[model samples]
Target: MNLTTKILLPLIWLLCAIPAGLVQAQQAGQTKDNPSYAALADLLENEQSREKLINELRTMADETATQAETVAEEASAASSSSRELAQTTRAIAEGIGEQFTALAEVVNGLVDGQVASDEQFSLAGLMEATLNLSLVIVATLLVFMLMRRLIGPLLYARLDNWALHGAGNTPVIRRVICVALAAAVDVVIVGLAYVGGNLVATFLVGESGEQTTQASLFLNAFMVIELLKAGLRMLFSRRYDGLRLLPINASEAAYWNRHMALLIGLLGYGVMVAEPLISIHISAALSQGINTLLMLAAFMYAAIIILKNRRRLAGIIRTKAEQSPMATSKISLHLLARTWHVLALGYFAVVLVLVLLSPANALPFVLFATLKTLGIIVVGLLLSTLLGQTIGRRIQLSPELRRKMPLLEARLNSYVPNALRFLRFLVLAAVILLSFNAWHVLDLATWYASEAGGVLMGRIIAVAIVLAVAAAIWVTCASLIEHKLNPETGTGIPSARTQTLLSLFRSALAVLLVTMTVMIALAELGINIGPLIAGAGVLGLAIGFGAQKLVQDVITGIFIQIENAMNTGDVVTLGGITGTAEKLSIRSVGIRDLNGTYHIIPFSSVDTVSNYMRDFAYHVGEYRVSYRENIDDAIAHLQNAFEELAADEAQKPYVLEALEVAGVVALADSSVNIRVRIKTVPGMQWAVGRAYNRLVKMHFEQAGIEIPYPQSTVHFEGSRQGVAPALKLEQAGERYSG
Candidate 1:
């Protein structure tokens, strides 16, 4: 605007413009305060916040996409790995299938006789086998001939001498020696044959093929088996002239010998043939079939023999049962016989099944197991019988044992059979363990080595040893105590008190020993004996509380016994009861009064005890004499009576000291009192007193010394007017009548 006027005009224009600018500014301020404009500003701010939130969401989405891609890549890699692993597993399976197929083909070929053709049926093999067989037969014949020519004659001579010299009267030892000599001869012959056979077989099949090795084995087995059979036949011959080991009838011996030989031969043949077939790698199916037939035939033969002899077996079992010492043992024998019969049948059935179902390779093991079981049983029976008989005989013959424990001897005689049965059980357990080991059924050693089993076994062994030791100690102590307590002619008899104390002590010792044993056993068994001991302590405390009176009585009685205060047969006054102590126990004293009433007084209740018969007792007698009699004479008479009692042969031992008369102990109105005292041995006071009193009465009567009852004189004051008193009484009676 212009400066002056223009200033005015400019002022106006400026005022107008200022007004307009103020109006616009105020309107703008108002619009800002308006609800719609404020809402728009808030909407803008919200849009900006939403835009920021959208940007963050887009970043998160991108990151999530990257993570998902990584996960997809991992899944794809895992899938590829799994596919590769599956393909590898499939390839391995296919390889295994091919190997199995090849093995099957080899087995099929072998079973089809392709592998064993050359070894089994070749001319060279046949010739070698025949040669070996011929050599074995010739060697056996030579050995038999040599035995017959040299050793057999000598053996027969000795046997014949034994039979002629003793026969039925022969001692067991001599018979056993003759039998042993015969067995030796047979063994020598068989041993020679077997050795020769082995030499021939080895020479013929030296380092040869499977067929040759089989032939060698067959030849040796056959020779040994045949020799054993022959030896058995010779030992068990039915002929009386022959050496027979067992005492059996001719018919029974013959039956057993024939059947046993046949059974042995059949079993040996099966074993020999089956073993070779398996060793030579013959066809499995063919070998199994042949073994099955052989086992079946052997079993059938055994069954036939057993069935035919079943009656005989039953009779034998019954005879043994009847002869058994224990009646209960008959049941056991019957059970054993039944079990044996069942086992025989079951074993045959099981073996037949095994031969049919199992491979040829298992046949030898089965047969060996069966034979081993049989051998163990026979050996066990023989050993048990020998040990039982020898030990039983020795026990029965022991004079000292019989004298010391007559009752025990009788019991032992009765229990000898049971002891043998226990031995048999032990043998059975051992055999069962051995059989399990052979079959590899259970690893006992490994099990025993484990923590729990080791501890358990140790506990068992320790408990057994401890129990045995404890029993020995108990028996020894009991025997000694019994010997001490016995009332023999020369030995001092045990008094009732001594006997009672000894009995109580023995019972207490037994209780302590049993308690200790139980605790030790529980500890060994892995039981927490600490708690048991604590419980015992608590229970003892409770008993002490509950039975305090009993405990007190026992303690008091013990002290009294230790102090020798009273004993049985002593005249004692306990509490207020006076009687003879009949019995003494730990808790109470039993007494019998003169009235025949028994009193069992607890020691706790006995506050004061007075034993009359300790080391010595006193017997006192009182005699009253008339005043007219001479005191000196009466005293002298009493002394004479006492002296007479002391000199008496029947009362001399009871009277320890001479009697003394104390003159004039008390004087009554009519008589003088005199006392005589005698010292006597214990438990004789009453007898001495009675005798002294009776003697005093007899002496007083003989000496004319009056021993009188109590007397008193009464003085009456009779006035000089005794007649006036009588008159007054008469007049008073008359006046009362009026």
Candidate 2:
């Protein structure tokens, strides 16, 4: 009904009927009542017993071989006499019948044995299935190989030539060719593996020529291994070529070295995967060990080259820094040290990973361990490179520092960057290891060693040592900041007291963080941490009560910080103490008084705050003029002067707007007073008022307006002496002079 059945029907019938017709042609007596033949016939008793019949017929072939051998021997003895030969033939017939009966018994035992065995997966069934599958696969591959070897090549040849003609640079064509070649290789290699596996399955259980089966299995395995080797070599070769095309020459060289190392590593992996399967064929442990060592040596040599290169760069950078010391950062040396440490760690990681993933080999393991250690040392140099570059990008030195250390510029610019990159690599390594653990491919306990019981106590000690070193560093940094901010009691370093407090605060915080981190890390390592947690809690509570003022200061400081009421250089009056603000820190506020004395006030004491620099200010004063001067005239003069000053080039920049006088503000005893008010720049009110006063003075003098002063006239009549005149005048207008 289907195309496959339609096509296969005729071929099947022809092959089957040919064998049937031959069997039919045999005479009835000649067909023999042999038990072996009867057993074979019984196997085909039902349509479902086709496989059983085929297996039985194949078994009968063995009996036929034995019978033929006996008949040949008897005929040889009777070759000289026909009667003797005929008698021998009859004897052979009786012998053949007996042999056939024995074979039938054997066949029945085999069938019974198969049935008696656990039937989860039958060797007989597997053999039959494998043989059938192999036939189909082989036929399909035959057609595929023909197409690949013939039509595929032909098409490529035409297309490649066409590509060349169309484009001078035929990179596309080259890529296509490369891809095609790779694909062809993959097809052939994988196809062979499939075929080899199938054939081996058939030979193990199928009823066939034992010698032929063994031979086929051997050839199939050998071919598969050869194909795998060829495929690996092809892949490595292409990768090597591709590595040469990178933009950076150094990077390319490094890549090539690393690439070769990886290839060698892959070779080691192959040997490991293949050795168990092929151990029966090749049992030479010494030879296998040698090959594994050789592969490891290749990678070790590559790592050495990369490490050596990194070290050389680091040394060059250091030399450059020394030559131009002014060019490096203030923290250049510190960063360099960190870089070295990280690099060494990374190098060790690479070596360790490679060795762990590789198969165990005696000489190779020793050599790889040595290389790993050496590589780790070199890793520090690599780390320094990135660190140098990163420092260069972030903190640019003052011009003076640059001039002081000229060679340091290049070192900072180059090595720092490499060190930063190395740090990133280390972080990535940790992440990758964690990811492997998550994936169940790696065990975290095994990785840290401290997680395992008993023997891991040494690791715990080492971790403690590391934590101690970290705490020391933290404390040292705190001490430095303290010394910078606050000097000794007798010392006259301004803000020394503040600096000392800040340093103490920082040191305390650092200690707390370090201690907590150590506790957490220990817990992760599965340490018993109950006492540590209790101690920390008690210590925290004790410190909390003792540093209540400090805590309050910090809290109040935080409010100030959040509100942004004042910054580094604002003038503020707080707690009735006014001064120009110098610095606003988390724990305290620094201010310089008007007398130039510095005050470090804790934020807790700063409940009331007055900020002077907000919005605007005012300049108010009273101006006087003569009573003889008209109010309108004085006002007109003041307005003119105010307008002129506002328009002046020197005053214009500071003046936000021109002044407008509010006239006739008050009437005094000596003069009609007028208040003139004007809006001005926020902080420029003083300057504006000053400039206006000067202008108004000059203009009022020109306008002849007299500024009135309190005066009185006294008169004495010369008659009757001064006494009589004083009395008479006092009684009259009360005009007197003294």
Candidate 3:
């Protein structure tokens, strides 16, 4: 163990350990032998394997370096994206901070008057502007007050009379028109006031024709606010009750009008006058701040109004709804009663947010949106009302027309009521959606101006045209069928068979038209009808398999109809039930018997149909007479009875042929049966038979022809005791009448 030997041994150990550790750490990949690492020391013993191991090491090292580079590149890219996102966020935050700082700075400038007024204005510019605006307002008010005092009473009286005389579908409608006219009058007053104010601003205030900013602001505010006040008068109309539009009474209307006008005026004046005046002299920030405070105040006021009147107004509306004649109006009134406050609050809240977000143009936008919403609602209501008036609640055909076409009005009514409701619903939804668009809650305006909107509108129009055509075709076909069935149209009364076939045809035509219209409408709406049609066909096949009895009924009925076995209004015997066929359908027959019992018999249940009224019918009479009577005389009397029946106005038309007598039909135990037959029109045989029998009874009585009835003949030899028998006849269960 020399020093040189120890140093060499330690250095060799270190070299061997370093290589093993390097291979294990660097090579994580596995091999076919389940080994991921192989030290150079282990491979050095095999000279041929050494080269392969070296190659494998070189390959693993290269792969490791490539993977690390890829991971580094990915991490670097991720870092770069994150950094960019952070920078963008920081920039947005900084921009917001700068905007806020600017707002604060501009707002602060007012405290020390640091903001520069225009060269045309001075240090006291805001005060002078306020004074000029106040004078113009006073002048406008003076003009309005003078004119109102002169004609207000007379105008109200005339308007009230006109409103009372106005014709409309509903009282609310007529009064609404009157109120609108009244509002127009108020607008005219405002127009006069605006003109006066304009003159004062131009001449008295020495402003040019263009008018200074403050003068213009004041003049515009006066006109807008006064016009709003006038419109409120329509709803209120405390003095002229006939001009009131709302359902509320005069007191409530006045109270609401006063409060709402105050709030509206405050908000309007603040936004139109104060803000603009401040912006002209102080700063835009101060103007915005004032507007924010004004809006908040108005909101608080509106909240108070809602809290005070929510329940009371709801009760009033509930009463009105109960009193309403129209079901739809009642439902709408009830809904509005419940949601009115929520809707009003939402409107104000939206406007507030908008004004705060963009103080420059938001106020004007909100104002215009309010006007647009009102106009849209008014127009929609008018259109729906006009439509309702045109269609009415039910189809009412003239008596003559109804007689000529019994089912035409019924068929029209079947579609009309539902279509009317659907149309009204569509109108209401459009109005609401348009209102939302006006409020900027939706982008309908933008969409309506786009290419897709044009295409959708075109498709909708095409669908409407298709539906219209379908409706016209259905009406024409139905009318023709109805006319054919009618006896009053100069055309002769149709046969029972023809009537039934035509009725069934009309129904089938209606079904086909409806189906085609629906498919075409769905296609126009961009729905694929192919799958729907296939599904329907499959469903029909399945139904046919599952409902064999129903199929049998339909098939049997169709064959029976084709053969003209029976028809509506025919006297027929079906399934042992003798009745008149009141209604005939594809799969069933509705029969009403003499006892007023109605039977609905499926065609499958009817194996036989014995139509008594097919063509001509026979009234066969078998009259029994005593053996002693002459058969020729009895037969002659029967012929006389038929002759009398033929002479009757009611029965004459029923007799088709003279009587055919068959004398001595049979010799009964006590009487002779003489049979006679007479032919009459189909369906009138029963009446003719009844009349003939009555005549025969009368004729037999006059001719002394003994009509022998069942009786027991008593003789004196009866008692069996060789005593005379006495018989007394008495009636049981009989009540004598005077």
Best by TM-score: 3
Question: How many times do residue backbones clash in model 3?
Answer: 0
Answer with 1 or 2, whichever has the higher lDDT.
1
Q: On residues 1-738, what C-alpha lDDT tens digit does candidate 3 reach at each position? A: 688965644454333324444465347553545232233344455566566656766886799999999999999998998898787667645644555676677656656657634433356666776677778878988999988877688786787887777665465567667778778878888888889888888888745665778888878887788877776676577777888765467788778888988988899888888888877777665565566678778988888888788888888889988976568778998999999889888888777666666667888898888888977886787667656665575779999888888888998888776677778878888998999888778998678789998889889889978987998798888888878877888569887788899989988887888998999999999999999999999999999999999999999999998899998999999999999999999999999999999999999999889999887999888999998889888888888888888888988888998898877889888889988888989988888889989999999999999999866775555656776655544569655442
Candidate 2 lDDT tens digits, 90-133: 76455445545544553464466522122232556546544654
Distance from true location, Cα of 551 in model 1, Å: 3.3
Give lDDT tens digits, candidate 1, residues 173-258.
Answer: 45556666766766777667666656655564444333355555555666667666655654466655436545456677788888
TM-score of each: 0.62, 0.32, 0.73
- lDDT leaderboard ranking: 3, 1, 2
Deviation from native of the Cα of residue 283 in model 3, angstroms: 7.0
List lDDT for all candidates, in order.
Answer: 0.68, 0.55, 0.80
What C-alpha lDDT does candidate 3 achieve relative to the native structure? 0.80
Error of 1 at 710 (Å): 12
Per-residue lDDT, model 1, residue 516, is 89
Point out the worst 10-residue segment of candidate 1 by lDDT: 10-19
Q: What RMSD, rounded to one decimal, does every model reach?
A: 18.5, 32.7, 10.0
By summed lDDT, the worst window of 10 consecutive residues in model 3 runs over: 32-41
| Model 2 misplaced regions, further than 4 Å | 1-570, 575-579, 592-598, 624-632, 648-676, 704-738
